[model samples]
Target: MNILCVCGNGIGTSVLLKVNVESVAADLGVDVNVTTSDAGSAKGTANMNDLVLTSAELAPELEGT
Candidate 1:
């Protein structure tokens, strides 16, 4: 599974979320390829991922993606 974690800058909170997601997925024995993206660029790549994780404030921008 591919997961994309998004944040304002794509380097701070998103990176943290990526690590956590990876840990949780590992615990569950689920294989996932996780990546991070900023709100500005996420829309373009969001659909490529199986799941897109982002804050509510940024959710609207990724709608339909």
Candidate 2:
């Protein structure tokens, strides 16, 4: 699965969440291709990814996927 962790800058919060997701996926024995992206980039990239992870306030901006 391709997962995207999106945030404002794509360097801090998104990276942190990506690490946590990686840990959980490893524990669950799930192989996932996870990436981190900023808000603006996420809209362009989300279509190619299987899942988009972000805060509730930011999620609406990424709708219609």
Candidate 3:
């Protein structure tokens, strides 16, 4: 699975989430690709991704997906 963790700055909170997700994947013995991206970059990017993880305020932007 491909997971994208997003935040305003795409540094602190996103990085923390990425670490936790990685630990969970390790315990489950699953192979996944995790990435961190800024909300702006994520919005502008044209590439396809499996999922978007973000705060409640940001959720609405990704609702249709």
RMSD of each: 0.5, 0.7, 1.9
Q: What is the C-alpha lDDT of each candidate?
A: 0.97, 0.94, 0.80
- Best-to-worst lDDT order: 1, 2, 3
Best by lDDT: 1
lDDT at residue 52 of model 3 (Cα atoms): 77
* Candidate 3 lDDT, 9-53, residue by residue in tens: 889888999999899999999898999987777775414677778
CA displacement after TM-score superposition, residue 56 of candidate 1 (Å): 0.6
**lDDT (Cα, tens digit) per residue for candidate 1, span 9-52:** 99999999999999999999999999999999998999999999
Off by over 4 Å in 1: none
Stretch of 10 with least lDDT, candidate 1: 56-65
Model 2: how far residue 15 lies from native, Å: 0.4
Better of 1 and 2 by TM-score: 1
lDDT of 2: 0.94
TM-scores of all predicted structures: 0.97, 0.95, 0.83
Residue-level lDDT of model 2, residues 1-65, one tens digit each, is 99999998889999999999999999999999999999989989999999999999889989986
**Is 2 or 3 the stronger prediction by lDDT?**
2
- Backbone clash pairs in model 2 (N, Cα, C under 3 Å; residues 3+ apart or in different chains), count: 0
